[model samples]
Target: MLFSLVKKDLLLAKKYLMFMTIFSFVSPLLIASRSSFSDTGFVSLLITVLLTEYILYISISSLEDKSKGAALLCTTPYKRNGVIKAKYLLILIIFMCCFILYTILTYLGISPNIQQMSITKIGTIMLVLSIFFGILIPVQVKFGYEKTKYIGFIIVFLTPFVLPNLIKWYTSSNLSINFTISLSQNIYGWIPFVLSLIIGYISMQVSIRIYSKKDL
Candidate 1:
């Protein structure tokens, strides 16, 4: 039942998925051209942008039918929790597609060097994305689609501008300057990543709970 709901949703969203695929393939080339073939920042920025776009697009697409009352997925035999799980499943699949595309581009020399990749950086990126998605999904479920879209847009636009400066301020004033990254070759790199994952998981659970109780 859950699978059926997911399939229906995906069928409706196929056009967007196709767009994402084409974008993923072209992203590396675009980044390379923009950066004058500078590998690191361009690839990182491209990956970040691609992931953000896909996450938002999928979230919006998934809720479209529900918002319009054109379909009855929310009223199916599947538990609301199962419906949510299906979303995560679809998201993971889409995310994997992006990862694979990026990997191929890296290998083909259109992207950055794979060997220079920092697990910490990747983990941080995933954590940020998880938090963004986690916050947005439940809000969409509770408040309906249009309001959530505005809220999501505001957060996405503001966060990149806000976070770095906030971080710099905090670090500069702190005496210890203690910050951690996950997956550093040294023993401590995993701390921030693990912590972020935990937070992301908790945020997801909260979103699920909110969604489960909503009148949709």
Candidate 2:
């Protein structure tokens, strides 16, 4: 039943996936060619892949709202918990696919220094998705995407800017919060993955309860 819901989402967002695949290959070439990049463009690779999928998932909510899909789903025979689980799982699965796509391209001898997509890199990606899902889903479920649209835009605009600065600050600052995410694979690789799992789990539970109570 959960699989069916995921399939429905995939079907509805087929065009987004189609567009993502094209960028998956093309963006790497462009980023690798740019002069201002360090980490040999791997930063760009991760950001581009993540932002593309993040926007697509958020767009799905907007689409669902426009079509009254969530309101209708609430009236269906399906369990509300299943709807929440499948939605969260869908984001995880798409993130894995994008990671794998880049990994394979680099494995085939493509450069930009993506020789291997590290556990920490993938973990950080999941953390980003988890944060967005944790905030976006409950508000969206409770208020509908129409009410959440501006919040989503602000988030979308702010995230890319904020994440990099946070990374820079953590990497360079003398504060007690001394941690470099890019190098965490050695010291704290598992932290982001574990934290994201915890966060995503809690988010799912919250969404389930919110969705179940809503009169939609």
Candidate 3:
């Protein structure tokens, strides 16, 4: 049953999966077409990776809701927890595959230096996704996909402005940052990663609860 649920989402999301796989390969070349092997190419590649991964996950889940698939799933014998669990698992599988593809292209001299997509970079990307899905899934699960656009607007417009400044502040502070320093030591430099995981889990719980009580 669990496998079936996962398969269902994957089947629903195959188009997103296919598009991202192709984009992950061609994007780096497109970026490098203008800048050769410079930092701009690397930056563009990363941004493109980040954007496509975000879209891949967002569209998979959002489209299901928009298509009334979520409502249909509710009427099935499948449990709400399974629906939430399968969705998160599907995103993670796709994300890691895309990230690995990005890493491979970088190493194969196709893409610019990705520096192995270091754990910190990977975490940052995952964190952004965590926050996105964390907020999006609940809204769609409860209010339907139509309401998700408002949150989508917030992520699109606000996060770009907010995250860079937040990362800058976190990286630049000194003794005034003793508390954050403590967190860094205690969490083994995974504070954002940990927090995002927590948020995603809580959001999944919220969605399950909402979907359970929702009018199918």
> Which candidate wins on TM-score?
2
- Candidate 3 lDDT over residue span 29-61, tens digit each: 665465423343334444555566567656666
Ranking, lDDT, top scorer first: 2, 3, 1
RMSD list, candidates in order: 4.8, 3.6, 4.5
- Evaluated against the true structure, the overall lDDT of model 2 is 0.75
TM-score-wise, the better of 2 and 3 is 2
Q: lDDT of candidate 3 vs native? A: 0.67
**lDDT digits (tens) for residues 88-176 of candidate 2:** 88888787777777777787876645556567766776787788778888887888877877886786667556655665676578678
lDDT of each: 0.59, 0.75, 0.67
Q: How does each model score on TM-score?
A: 0.71, 0.83, 0.73
Give me the candidate number with maximum lDDT: 2
Better of 1 and 3 by lDDT: 3
For model 2, the stretches where C-alpha displacement exceeds 4 angstroms are 35-37, 40-42, 158-188
Model 2 clash pairs? Answer: none
Q: State residue 211's C-alpha deviation in candidate 1, in Å.
A: 2.0
